[model samples]
Target: MTAAEHLLAAKSFAELRGSYSGALFIIASGPSTKAFPLQRYADYPMLALNGSICCLAEAGIAPLFYLCDDSSFVRNRLPLLLQALAHAQHLALSPRVVGSLLAQEPQALDGRSAYRFERVNRLPEGGEAMSDRRFARQARKDPDFECDFSWFRQKPNRIGFSRNLDKGYFSSRTIPYAGIQLAYHLGFSRVFLVGVDLDSSLGRFYEQGEQAVKSRLDGDYEDYILPCFRLMAERVINPGFQVYNLSANSRLPAEVVPKIDLDQLDALLAAS
Candidate 1:
């Protein structure tokens, strides 16, 4: 069966809609996230994306949800991903990723953790799917070209061709954007982002001393990363829901989303 078919047969996310009306912390793997006080927000619901799991584990912080969409991560770093899986209560992945793991090593999904599988559409209607390098060039010239996120406001279980360009819940260029959609699906009223520095030069905190993965930070940020934030500002943030950038040095503009320091976290939570 296709990933879309699997999503159709799986349990609906409606049961978790608005389940967590409190604050949510989304941990990105950016180097700035290393400064975040994990223990301070230990009780808060947290979602860790990709390599951020390494730092979270080192800090003895276990995220509630672990999210990833790239199949290459599974193909190249299966052991690390599995290690992170042990620390998360739930796992969210794309249907393509699920299929890849099941086909390569089905034991990876032997009911060790709860799963939320989403259909990922990299290409939207009326657009040609281009390479990353080419897409970035186009995005740099066209500010209007952005991934659509309207599907997130609808019921979660309804399955169809939910393009990332049309539905924010579907996979985008970055996993953190998908994490935001998951947080909203679970009914979080406020979302906080940490370690989303979007700086390629600084690299990832977990890979500071070790061999670092090659990154297209400059292009990807200008093209895909920044647009995701802009989309959130326009579509997701409202009286019903708000997203805050907690990384003080994050590249995201304050106009897109308010940036707050860790010291203000207590006050923010209290006000919430």
Candidate 2:
């Protein structure tokens, strides 16, 4: 299908609101994911991110929802992205990713159920004049920068977790945050984050050496990623929308997202 046709076929986020009321898993590309038992959740809905779909393919299962927040991956690794999209039951792509796919392979999303979401660009709340100037310059230069600056114009210039995805989602330098927001929009009660190890030294489980994708996690962790999770913990994650981390060794503090082993996860699921 052509990109225009794909757009015509794409479903709106509003259609997905409150569609699911059960537990779901978000598979990320952390090195620890190599050990995750994906087959155990074959019957359950799983959301795969970036190259993490390789793990799902290895388990001979397809992801219920697949998201690629990075357009660079679609440009640099089109084959892998296409491979994942072929097996994914649903798609959640940024506009830039869709544009890249349109340029690379207009027919890629044929007959697929997809939802497109915009990213919220957050400028520092305080009078960080230098940072604001830098961001303005970068936004002016980058053609694919699809940031919703609506929050920036507000009085306090606040940034927090997006409970309603149709408005837009905050980009925390990690695609997992998008997945979590998508889960919330889909009405999931319990969300499991698998392979969310924030350590950049280990690299991804699916790629190594020259084959690995470049990472900005080390630089973005403290300033962007951690603070975003803390905001989510404070504002969004409640009994109704509980989020659990399966990656025990993740760099994220336990207070931000409670960590649990598979046994604990199973018990929680059983209890629910």
Highest TM-score, which number?
Answer: 2
Candidate 2 lDDT over 31-127, as tens digits, reads: 8898888898787899999888888987888898888978899877887798888788888887778878888777777677788766645322332
lDDT of 1 at 12: 48
Candidate 1 Cα outliers beyond 4 Å, as residue runs:
1-10, 119-170
Per-prediction CA RMSD (Å) = 7.7, 6.9
Instruction: Assess every candidate by TM-score.
Output: 0.76, 0.85
Best by lDDT: 2
Model 1, residue 234: C-alpha shift (Å): 2.4
Clashes of each: 4, 0
Each model's lDDT comes to 0.68, 0.78
- Candidate 1 per-residue lDDT, tens place, 91-191, comes to 77666677776766656655555455543324423456554444434443433233332223321211111212223253446677777777777778889
- For candidate 1, the per-residue lDDT at 36 reads 83
